[model samples]
Target: MAAPPEKKTLRIGVLYEHTQMTDLAGVDILGNMSTKSVNLVATLEPRVSALLPLSTPMEFLYISSTLEPSWTTPDMFVKPTHTYANAPRDLDIIMLGGPDPAAAHEDSITFLKKASKQTKWILTTCTGGMWLARAGVLDGKKATTNRMFVAKHAGEWFPKTEWLDQRWVVADGEFEGAQIWTSGGAGCGESYVSNTR
Candidate 1:
């Protein structure tokens, strides 16, 4: 009898602080794909052969500068699973949601600069691309952010990056060995994730 395919765990770090929850729609889709409920359904229903869970397992790390809960809005928050200093160094993917550009801390930016070089993929939604630009990873790379932000501030803030006015943009070329995937406003993040899948 042949052996089953090995399942490798995909570690994804979600970097956020004061980020809009809607900006993380794509990550949520990925999470759904990795859920046990879907896997159970796929295994039990032979007739629904098309319904399959992700081939590899997935682990999500909610990262923040500190262990404290990070606010998504005034009343809602997500607790950090790991801090920048202690988070695993070898992550397969790093996901970023739109946060206030000026509110990003130097430590978080530094962590991103290091993570970008080691991670296989960097997915950003809305102003998250701006954070990558702040880390100097997006310089000389073609990326897209929220269209409103692109028109008003992205160009002036990150002149080195070629910002585009699109719903989503994929820069397949390696930026320190990581491919960047960026998307504009709400719901577009989900679109980007669908394309990747």
Candidate 2:
């Protein structure tokens, strides 16, 4: 009998600080794409059984500038699994949700600059693209942000980037070999994730 192939784990680094909860909704969908969910679907349908082994297991590392909890709202927050300085270098994906652009920390911007080179994908929701812009990762890249922000400040603030008026933009240029994806305002993240899947 042949042995099963080893499962590949998809490491995702979720960066957050004063992020909007709605912007992070796509992470939940990503969490549901694990091997366990694939098995459940196979059991329920009895089809796609042969494709179950192709599903990659996913691991999410909630990252913050500090070890303390990161607040998404005045009442809600998410604890950090790792700080920017100590996060794993082998992240497959770097995900960011909308946070107050003015409140962005220098450390976070620095981390994004470094991580973008190593990660396969960089995903941003709403104003989260601002951090990438501040990091200079979005410079010369075709990207989009919250529609309101794109119309008002994205162009003026980040003139180097080609800001587009769209629900979301997926730029697959050689950004240190990373594909960048940016989604507009709240709830657009859900559409982005679903379409990407």
Report the C-alpha lDDT of model 1 over 1-197, residue by residue, as the tens digit. 97767767789899868788888877778876764546766678755435543444789899999989888954688999999888885788888889887778778888987887778888899899898889888888899998898976999998999999988888863545557898888667777665554
- Score residue 124 of candidate 1 by CA lDDT: 92
Worst 10 residues of 2 by lDDT: 188-197
Task: Give the per-residue lDDT digits (tens) of candidate 2, residues 1-197.
Answer: 88987877889899878888888888888877777778788888888676676667888899999989888865697999999898986688888888877688778887887888778888899999887888898988899988899977999988999999898898873445667899888767667665444
Runs in model 2 lying further than 4 Å from the true structure = 36-54, 173-177, 194-197
The number of clashing residue pairs in model 2 is 0
Give Cα-based local distance difference scores for all models: 0.81, 0.82
Error of 2 at 147 (Å): 0.4
Per-prediction TM-score to the true structure, in the order listed: 0.88, 0.87
Give RMSD (Å) of candidate 1 vs. truth.
Answer: 2.5
